[model samples]
Each structure stands twice: as structure tokens, then as C-alpha cells.
Target: MSSSAGTSTQGEPLNATALNRQLKVMQDRINQLEAQLQAGSGAPRAKAGEGTPKERKRVKLSAPREFDGQQAALAGFLIQMQAYLHFYEDQFASEFEKVTYAGTRLVDKALTWFEPILKDYYENGDQATDFTKKVLNSYADFTEALSRVFGEKDEARRAQERLTHLRQTKMHFAATSTTTG
Candidate 1:
């Protein structure tokens, strides 16, 4: 057999024997790693009651004590409503802009009704309990009313009436409570 010379593209003589030795060394290291992995011995083992150096102390977590069930229910209702609105918008993209505008107006009207109750709850500590009750009752009432309105033949008219009733009831309450006190 004739011995052939190996030369790089740059015309420099290449050491084939040295390259083969280096390749063998890398292959051996890879084989050793693979054997260790197969034996489940790649990582250092820690005995019982002698945890690994990188082990962290476990912590227990709990839900917030101040989370109100009623408030959570109300928030869930709002989230459901928002999801329904998004679905509606997707289904009727042609009329979505107008519907969104009307929805914003409705929300603004509702916020106007709610602002006083929130203000009263924040400003007067004594009235907070009463205001909270009012807010929760309003949420429950509105949910029921909305369900009923959606079930009716004239949903738009019924929805408008429901909103009007909510606004008028709160206004009347505010007027009566201020006069009485």
C-alpha cells in the first residue's frame, strides 16, 4: 500500500496521525459519558437525610385570607361577560365597532352609578360595610337582571330598562340616606 500525504486547502501539510489520536480521545470521553448516563450515575448521588448542595428548602403557600367569595363571584361574572363580548365581536366583526362603542357607553353609565358607592366606601369607614353590601347586592341583581333580559324577546329594551333601574335605585338611596342622616 502506498502512503498518501494529507494537505490542507492552503497547501500546508496536515498531521493525519495526530488528528486521529485527538479524535480517539474525544470518542472515548463520549463513550464514558454515555455509559455513566445509562447507569444513572451522571449526577452525584446524595444519601437519605443528606440532601444535595443545590437542594432548596420547600415552602408552603396558601390563598389570601382577605379574598371575598362574593367579590370573586362578581369578578368571575365580569370575566365571563368579557369573554362573551370577545366571541360576539369575533362572530360579528362587521358590526363590532358600533357594538363596542355602545358597550363602552353602557359601561360609562354603570361606572357613573358605581362611583358614588365606591367613594362612600372609601371615604367613610363606618359606611364601608353598608356600601360593600350594596355593591354585592348590585352585582347579584345585575347578573340576574341581565340573564332575564337576554332570555326575553326584546333584549335591548329590557337591558336598557335594567340599567335605568340600577341608576335610579342607587340615586334614590343616596338621596334618602343623605336626607335621613
Candidate 2:
């Protein structure tokens, strides 16, 4: 019986060593269980008919658009006026009739596009302001020339003077009228 007990004891380590080995085994088992639980929880989430993970389920914009119609009309008018001025050279006068027609068309379109803005300003009683002032001043010059051409004192002289005034002033009509109709 003593010989059998000794043989069994020889196969086993000391108490401390045995305890350490048991602890390591337990720790390894705990680590494996933790890994399995984590994996189970993180299993591929079922997507509800949505294509792939990379595909967005919904689109959202961060901000609203800001646009001012009056400002836009003012800018367009300036561009058209610049183009008209460039065509006033002597070389361009050879195509005067066509250029005039094009200028008229541009002005018409500008007026049409800007009419609503003008109407709003007039109705609001804020008409005689900024760009409107410049435009009316220019129109006054043009009408002055038109009146001269229809036979004012020294029709030729006055007409030439009006033309010269326009060339000097280089004005455009106001987008809005201060005086309400």
C-alpha cells in the first residue's frame, strides 16, 4: 500500500505547483468562454433587405439652399450691359442693326425677369434705391437724346449733345421705378 501511494505521489507536482497549473487551466477556459460570448454577440447583424453594409439606407442633406432672385437679376443685367457696350465700336457698327436687335432682346428679357422684383420693391416703397437710381439716371439721359432727335432747338446739335451725354454717362435703365403707376 505504501509503495502504490509513493508511485502516485511521484507523478504529481508539489501543492503550489499543482495549484498554479490548475489556475492556468481555469484562466485559459475563461478566456475561451469570453471569446465565444463576444463572437456570438457580434454575429453578422441581419440587414433588412438593404443591399450591402457600404450602401447607405438613407440620404440626408446638411443645409438648405439660399438664393435671392433680385440679386440674380441685377447681376444678369450688368452682364448684358457690358456685352452691349463692347459692341459699340466702329467695327461693330457694320452689324449695327443686328446688334441693336440683340440688345433690345436682352433688355426685354432682363425687364421680364426683373419685373417681379421691381413690382415687389415699388409695392414695398423701397424703389428709389441703389441700382435703381443709376438706371433711372441713365434712362433720363437716353430719353433726353430721344427728345432731341424728334426736333428740339438745334435738332442736330441737341441730338449730338444727347448722344455725347449718353456716351459719357454710359448709363442703363433702372430695374425698378420709384414713382408708382
What lDDT does model 2 reach?
A: 0.44
lDDT of 1 by residue, 1-181 (tens): 1133355555666577755765687799889988987898765555655774346343333211221223324445455554554544444444324233323333333445445545665587565765344443454444443334333457689789998887443534334434554
lDDT tens digits by residue: candidate 2, 117-156: 3454466545555543333335333223323322245758
Candidate 2: residue 104 lDDT (0-100): 47
lDDT score of residue 119 within candidate 1: 62
Itemize residue pairs with steric clashes in candidate 1: none
The root-mean-square deviation over C-alpha atoms between each candidate and the true structure, in angstroms, is 21.6, 26.8
